[model samples]
Target: MTELHIRAATPEDLDTVLAFWKVAAEGTSISDDSGGVERLVARDPEALILAERGGELAGTVIAGFDGWRCHLYRLAVHPDHRRQGIASALLAAAEERFVRLGGRRADAMVLTRNETAHQAWGAAGYGPEEQWRRWVKPLTDQVCSAARPDCSG
Candidate 1:
């Protein structure tokens, strides 16, 4: 196995990362588009970490920290690179970033149906929080109406 190189992704990496996710990642996300990822890279250049082996993308992990919370997402290892410590390497880089940024705890969004991921995360010292549930609403450009007072223009 070749040496693994970990680094922060740049604008040039957005397209490649998007394409890689389709093949390596477990599921799709609302923010999987180029625009969304571009915004992420722009907001925090170090948030998207990539692991490359012999110049080929081997794994990726988004270690986003919104000042108060550390959120991990899109942890994907190439099918050919599984069980080779790629995920662990990417996560170590992510955790190191979070700690440097003053983040206390890191949380990951793992799909409930992805049993393989459950085991991986569990082995990485992450477990499901039974008391907390995730709730989300996709933001859109549609104008807010009087009936939906919760939405603002």
Candidate 2:
């Protein structure tokens, strides 16, 4: 196996990143399109981090800092490359980024039903925030019915 290298994603990497997430990630997001990713990279070039080995993508993590808080998303490792510390490497890079940006706390949006991912986050020293709930409103009809009054499926 080739040595793992972690680095910030470039504009040219957007398509590859999207494709990688479809296979490696647990769930999908409304903003997972090319346009959304392009906007993200344009706004914050250092937010999206990637792990590569022998020119193949091994893992990905998005470390977004919105002035006061650090938000992590899409922390995915390819199944073939699991248990090889790729996730840890990506997270280390993210944490380092957060610290450099004056971010005191980091929060990740992990799926509740993903038990394996829960264990991974736990192993990485992150505990679940039982008191907190994620309230969301999808802007796109593809994810939620914007035409409906309550947006219920």
Candidate 3:
């Protein structure tokens, strides 16, 4: 087992990270594109953390702290790199970042059907807040506005 190195991602890593998500991540996100990720890196460079082993991207976690709350997203470990403590390492790093940022509690967005992810997140001491439900509304994009009459702006 090679030593794993964890570091914040840079602009040069945006394309590779996007491609890696397609292969390693469980699901897609609205902000998965190059532009969205580039904006994230531009806004907060240390939010996207990457784990590398032997020069290959083994895992990634987005540890975002927005003043008031800490959010974890896109925790993906490559299939070939599973069971190698990469996820744990990534979570530890994320937690440390949150603590540094004065965050009280950290929350993660895990898909309902991803049982494997459930197990991994549970193992990391994060449990689902079943009492609360998530509600989301996508801000209108140009195509959406053109297609839907209700889409304002």
Candidate 4:
């Protein structure tokens, strides 16, 4: 395995970052979106760290922190770059960043079917929340309008 230098992603690296997600064979909900990549870079480059092996993008992980808890998502290592410790390194960096910002804990939402991701998260000190499960539902414009009222949220 080559030395993977983890660093903040830049606009120039968006293509490679999105490309990695594009070629992922299976096991994630990340889409190949150019607009989304640029939006992330505009918000916080550190949240979208890129792993490079001798200047080539090998892996990426999007770590978002909301002042209290850190959320890790979109962790994707190129198929060719799997098993090289890149994902682990990226995770370590994310935790460090979260702790530095006074975060209490880190969280990640992996697909229930992705055993590989489950193992990686477990090895990184994340355990399955048998007592709790984070649930989310996408809201469309119609749903959003239906839920809105003159004095209610």
Please report how far candidate 4 places residue 135 from its true position, in Å.
Answer: 2.7
TM-score of 1: 0.91
Model 2 — which ten-residue stretch has the worst lDDT?
Answer: 144-153
Candidates ranked by TM-score: 2, 3, 1, 4
Best of the two (3, 4) by TM-score: 3
Error of 3 at 18 (Å): 0.4
Question: Which pairs clash in the backbone of model 3?
Answer: none
Range of the 10 consecutive residues with the lowest summed lDDT in candidate 1: 144-153
Full-model lDDT, candidate 1: 0.90
Quote the positional error of residue 4 for candidate 3 in Å: 0.3
Clashes by residue pair, model 4: none
Q: After superposition, how far is residue 105 of candidate 3 from its true place, in Å?
A: 0.2
List runs of model 4 lying over 4 Å from the truth: 25-32, 140-153
Q: Considering lDDT, which of the candidate structures 1 and 2 is the better prediction for this target?
A: 2
Error of 3 at 59 (Å): 0.4
Query: lDDT at 97 for candidate 4?
Result: 86
Residue 60 shift from truth in candidate 3, angstroms:
0.4
lDDT by residue for model 1 (86-149), tens: 9999999999999999999999998887899999999899999999988765576553455554
Candidate 1: give the clashing pairs. Answer: none
